[model samples]
Target chain A: MDATFRAMLEHGYNDLSIADIADEFEMSKSSLYYHYDSKDDLLVSFLSFASDRFEEDVLTAPTGDPMTDLEHVVEKLLPLELDEERRAIQTVMSELRSQAVTNAAFREQFTDIDDLLVAHLRVVVERGIEDGSFREVDSTRVAEHVVATLNGARVARATTNRTGAPAAVRVSLASYLDTVLRGRR
Target chain B: MDATFRAMLEHGYNDLSIADIADEFEMSKSSLYYHYDSKDDLLVSFLSFASDRFEEDVLTAPTGDPMTDLEHVVEKLLPLELDEERRAIQTVMSELRSQAVTNAAFREQFTDIDDLLVAHLRVVVERGIEDGSFREVDSTRVAEHVVATLNGARVARATTNRTGAPAAVRVSLASYLDTVLRGRR
Candidate 1:
């Protein structure tokens, strides 16, 4: 999985083949084929690993408040702390998003990941609603917006005109919470 | 421009090539070259045309109640009745957005189109603020969100994913505006 991720990140997902992955670890193509039938299997494996990492981060985050919890989700999405491996995960995830949109086979898994993220978001919002820390807002809608904002930030960071990275999303997220939550941190 | 737009919509920007556009219109390569220098130029022309269509809809829209007027702007983003051509334009737009993140050349032209879209949103938000139709919000930030959501919706529509279409965005837009406005629309 580590080797699969490294190659995908450095060269985009579409650009790699099974031989390339085997060659990276100095393994025969036949040897690599024993582990995974196809490139799609490799992609699915990488997504599973990545998804586990994201879930772990969400589960363990120290969110002081609902807003901070929301911020924590944003933090994970941004890929803020990075090495080549992290970059590859993010890049590969991006390609997966595009692929998911087009492939029904992948949609279920893509949605599963999206559901987890949204559920994580809903947890914070629901807690805020219960604690009177957040305004009376549709938690799902707000959660979707928050998710979209983070996704949107990925696109924003990609643009050459942008000065910063995903940190730009933090500013947008702050304003979004302020408007919807109305000053309850 | 039309041929390239159609090609990009059906096939993603990365999937199509300079020769594809030339073959579509039955024009010799050199003859097509007479009108435009490169593929990027052709892509830019399509963007400029889309920009014009957007401006025509928003700028010429009725300026009655700001909310009502803004609804018109929102409608422009939503494809009320999508013809084959309109869907093609939308698909191409999505491809542009996906690539703009990584390609400097695409980024430059995309930035111009983004500015125009943001300007339109800023005007509506400014009008809302002035008329007390919306709470005082950060106009630039809100404008950016509007653009982000618009782009996001375009992706959803192009994508085969069951969710994240322009229609979903329209539904979300209403709630999103309500969430942020903090006042009567």
Candidate 2:
């Protein structure tokens, strides 16, 4: 699964053939097929896998302070690494997004990630309101704002940085948190 | 040029072929060569052309209230089918950003657009302070935040809308402007 996921990251799952994967892993197509049903299956599996991990991290992870936890979540979720792992995840995201345009299955598979993130943000906003960390704004809408800004920054960082410096991602998240949580009074 | 730009948007510039563009346009390779020195020329021209028009409209053409000018500029930049040409221009912006990463030249071109937008935003923040439209903050960085939100909202609307409704973009922009500029003092 790691090999398959990494392959998808470097070259999109849509762009790669089973032969390509086999060549990378030094295995035959029959062997590869034995493990996975099809290309889409592999992608769906990857999405499910990542989504589970992300949900656990965002929702279940123990972090104190709503603002700190929110900032930490964005920092972790950002694909800010030059290694194959980060690239593979980014390629998967980009691929899933393109396929989601016309295909319902792909859209359904990836929608969970968006939902989980939004739900997590909403919790943070609610807590912020209680703790007086945020003003009286619509929590859901603010959550959407949070998701939009982070997603935008993620996509921007992916394109802008070739070596994938964590600094850019960190600065962006800090600024985002500062602005969104601005004027709590 | 249209074919190259379209190809870039659909499949990314690196993924598309000059032959695909040449055949689609029904033009000889020689003629294509005459018009453009290289594929770089084709892609750069598209970015340059779009950015040039965007600069003139958003930056050069001014309503004179730097604070309100930006709000108006965001309006002029993001419009509904209430008009045609404006919609087309915004469509171009939302579409190209997806492919901007694949081409280095195009990426650099986009950075210029981002920089110019940020620079103009800084001017707005500074005037906003004087005009009492905004409280004091890091004007330069705050400007980057504004552009990031606007650009992010544009992409989010492109991806999330089922019927391609333009209303989502407008409401989000209004909300963001309200958040950023509210005196709250």
Candidate 3:
């Protein structure tokens, strides 16, 4: 999986081939073929692997404070500074997401990932509302908006020359949380 | 350009070829080649064509009312109803945007499009603030947030099973406008 991810970041999704991944892998080409039938199959498996990692890393551990948890998720998804490694991962993810427009296998995995993120966000919002940290906003709607904005910021940061987008969104989201989500009482 | 658009929607970006475009074109494949050298050339041309259409349709002819003008841009970008035609176009755009991650030509075109949209949005926000329709806020930041959220909503609607995402974003954005942008006076 690490080999595939690294190879994908290096070669990109379209130019990447099984041979490239095999070269990156410690195992031989024959052994790689024995595991996965085709490039798409391997990529599909990679998506699943990435999804599991996302679930474990972003969703599993949440700080007790609902607001802090929400901020944590936002920071994980759209970090203000985006170091080289995280940028590479985001580039790979963006490439895969574009494929999801046409490929059902990629789409299915992305759907699951999207669902998990939104669900995690919804739960955090609900917790905030229940614990008096947040106002009485629609939790599902808030979750969707937060995810959508972060997704947009990530895309802009990766695909365009908008290097400051993630930071802009971070500041905007912080103000949004303070004014819109925070409870008066 | 019409033929290119139709052919892209029918065959998709990956499967699309000069022959397919020729089939959709009114003229001969030889004539099509006379205009463009390769499939990538034709696609780059198509992107410029689409960008012009978007600017003329969405950015021009704004209402005198700043708030109404803002809504007009948002509605055009993220309509509540994704009819068959609009959905197809959005899918194609999403595909092209994905390509931008790996392809420089596509990336350049998309960068222009993104800049145009953000600039138009910033002008609208500045207009609102000047005309006293909106509160004192950072016009550039507000514009970026609005565009990013819409972009995110569009991606979600295209790639995932989140059919209600556009509508949800529309509602959320409306509320955001009311609370955040609207002037107290």
Candidate 4:
């Protein structure tokens, strides 16, 4: 999967080929074809694998604090600062997302990932509300809003890092909790 | 430009050709080449032309209210609601934005459009603040957040409309004005 992702990063979606993925994977095309029938099939599986890793490594990398946990999710998805490898990954993911617009297979993969993130966010927000740590706002709405902001930040960061857009996603989420959804207020 | 944009909508960035655009425009390929050196050059020009049209048609569309003015801008961009034609356009624009990640020309075009929108939003927020209709918040930051949310909403709308993501963008913006940034509070 890493090899496949790396290949996609080097040669974009349009230019990438199964042979390229096979070369990166250090495997024969016939063996690769035995596992996955087509390039789209392999790519879809790759997206699913990436989603699983996101769930394991990032979402589950938690602190006890709900706000902190949510912030971490956003940060993991889009770093306030990115090194070369992470930026390359983001650029490739951006391309995949663009593909998702019209491709039903990609769309389903994205939807699954989006649904997972939003569900986790809803749980955290609801936890805060139940514990009396946060004000009564619609948890679902807040979750949806946060996910959208994260997606927006990804797009913004891809074009220009100077906007502080990624930082603002964290700030806006935190500030919403402090100002609009603070129980103490 | 319309022919180019329409071709993009029909064929997408990956598949679109100069011949395709020229066919749509009912012009000779050489004539089109006389104007635009390559497909990328033509697409970039189309983006610039779209930006100009946005600046003229939507930005200058008037209402007495600043809040209404801002809403109009978002609506023009994402259309809180979308018909098939609008959705198709949004999908093509999404592809262009993805291309912008690696393409400097597209990057500059997107940045220009983003900067223009954000600057207009800042002015509106500042105007509200001066008129004593809003609380003191960093107008620039507010503008950035709004732009991010708008971008996020565009992605969300392209997928599942069930999330109410478009409505959420508007709701978040209005709620910011009414709650956190309310002077009376």
Candidate 5:
């Protein structure tokens, strides 16, 4: 899985090959094929592995404060500055996401990740509302906004030259929370 | 350009070949090459064309009301039910956007589009603030959130099974405007 992830980062999903991975990892293609039938299968496994990592890294480390916990989630979701490997992985993920437009398996796995993020946001909003830390608002709607804005920030980071896009998102999200939870100015 | 757009929808940028596009369009590859040097050039031209269409279709039609004008921009930005052609164009755009991670040319073009969208949002926010319809806030920051959320919504639509992702974004954007513009709940 590590080999596949590393390989996919260098060679995008469309160009990723089992032989290349095998060669890079010093394994025979047949040996590699024994575990995964094709590149797509390897990518699927990679996606699953990524989801697990996200769960372990972000979902598990929850502070009691709903607002702070939500911030943690955002921080984990969008790294301050993606390193080389992180950027490569992100590029591959973007390719897989574009593929999801036609590929069902990719779509399902990506959807699972999306659902997980949105669900986490929803929980945080609901908790805040229940504890009176947040004003009464539609939890689901706010959750959707938060998730979408984060996703969009990722896109903006990848596509634009803007270095402060993530910080901007954080600022906007804080304002959003203030509007919803802290009431009017 | 129409031929290129249609072909790109079917075959993403990675797999797209000039021969395929030429064959599909009944144009000789040499003839196509005479105008555009590479697939990237063709794709770049297509991006410019798409930008013009967006300007013509959405930005040109502005209602007097800032709120309604903003909604028009949203409507034009995120088509509710993308037909086959629209979906194809969107998929192609997605692929090109991913390409921006590596290709400087694609990155510049994508950035221009992003700037255009953000500028539109900024204008609406400014107009609202000027007219006393919206509360005084950082127009630029709010515009960034609006653009990012919409981009995120597009990602969600592509990756998830959520059929109402566009509507969800619309609702979220409306809520954002309300929170910033409409005062307390």
Candidate 6:
């Protein structure tokens, strides 16, 4: 998986080939082929692997406080500062996402990832509502809004290098939480 | 520009070339080359052309009502039902947007388009505030939020074929406008 990530970063999604992945691999080409039939197969597997890691890292260990947990998720997804490696990952992910328009396999993976993110967010919102930190709004709707905003901010930042988008969204979302979600408080 | 759009819909952004565009053109390849040096140049010009059309169609002829105009902008951007041709166009645009992650020229064009959309939205929001149709919120922030949601919805709908995302977002945005932006009303 690391080799695949490195190869994608080096060659990009369009130029990346099985040979490239093999070259980056410590194992033989046959061994690599034994695991995945094609580049797309390998990439699909990589997406699943990455998704699992994201789930484990971001969703599983939620903070006790619902608001803090929500903030943590947002911060992880749309960090104001991205290192070089993170930026490359984002670029690669964006490239792969574009393929979802034409590729069903890629689309399925992305959809699953999005669903996971949204479901996690919904859980957090529900928790907040139960704990009296948030108002009695539609938790699912709130989750969707947060996910959409984060995704939009990430897309804008990645494609246009809009350095201020993430920060601006953070402030806007903070205000939204204060006014709408936290209204009961 | 029509030929470019047609060719893009046919071959998509990655597989599209000058030859493909020329094939779609009524004129000779020589004439096509007379105007643009490369496919990238042609695509950048097409982006500008599309932006102009968008501005004229969606922004120029406002309904003289700020709230209505704002809804028009959102509806045009995140239309719930996409025809076959519109779906193809969205796919092509999504493909091109992926390129913006790496291609500086594409990035610049997209940045300009985003700026235009956001600026237009900001103006409508400011007008709404002046007319007391909307609350005295930060117009720029509201505009940014609206654009981000629309962009995100488009991306989600195109990539995942999450057919309901656009409608859901439309509902969410309406509620947001009611609670936050239309608080004054």
Q: lDDT by residue for model 3 over B1-185, one digit each (tens)?
A: 88988988998888888888889989677889998988889999999999999999999776789889889999899988878989888988898888888778988888889889989988988888898888888877888889889999988887887777778888888877777787311
Q: Stretches of candidate 5 above 4 Å error?
A: A26-29, B26-29
lDDT, model 2:
0.62
Candidate 1 residue spans exceeding 4 A from truth? A26-28, A35-41, A59-65, A78-89, A164-169, A182-185, B26-29, B33-41, B57-62, B78-86, B153-172, B179-185
Q: Estimate each model's TM-score.
A: 0.81, 0.77, 0.93, 0.94, 0.93, 0.96
Per-residue C-alpha lDDT of model 3 across residues A1-185, encoded as one tens digit per residue: 99999899898887889989998999677989999987889999999999999999988676789988988898899887878888789989998888888888888888889889989999988998898888899988888888889989888886787777678878887877767787310
Q: Compared with the real two-chain complex, what DockQ does model 1 have?
A: 0.38
Please report how far candidate 6 places residue B74 from its true position, in Å.
Answer: 0.9
True contacts kept of each: 0.25, 0.17, 0.68, 0.49, 0.78, 0.54
Q: Residue B147 of model 4: what lDDT?
A: 82
Interface RMSD of each: 3.2, 4.2, 1.0, 2.0, 1.4, 1.1
TM-score of chain B of each: 0.77, 0.71, 0.95, 0.89, 0.90, 0.95
- Greater TM-score among 1 and 3 belongs to 3
Q: List CA RMSD, all candidates.
A: 3.6, 4.4, 2.2, 2.0, 2.0, 1.6
Q: Model 5: which residue pairs collide?
A: none
Over the full model, what C-alpha lDDT does candidate 4 score relative to the true structure? 0.78
Docking class of 4: medium
TM-score of chain A of each: 0.82, 0.74, 0.93, 0.91, 0.89, 0.95
lDDT of 4 at A47: 92
Select the stronger candidate by DockQ from 1 and 2.
1
User: Docking category for candidate 3?
Assistant: medium
**TM-score: model 3 vs. ground truth:** 0.93
Tens digit per residue, CA lDDT, model 5, A61-89: 66778889888888777878788877876
lDDT of 6 by residue, A12-96 (tens): 8888999999999996779899989999999999988888988998777677788889889888888888998778888888888
- Residues B1-185 of candidate 5 have per-residue lDDT tens digits of 87887678777676788766776676566778899888888888888888788777767656768888878877766878889766766777777787777778888888888888888888888988898888888888888888899899998887678776678778878878776766735
Q: Give the winner by DockQ.
A: 5
The TM-score, computed over Cα atoms with residue i paired to residue i, of candidate 2 is 0.77
Show the lowest summed lDDT stretch of 10 residues, model 1 chain B. B156-165
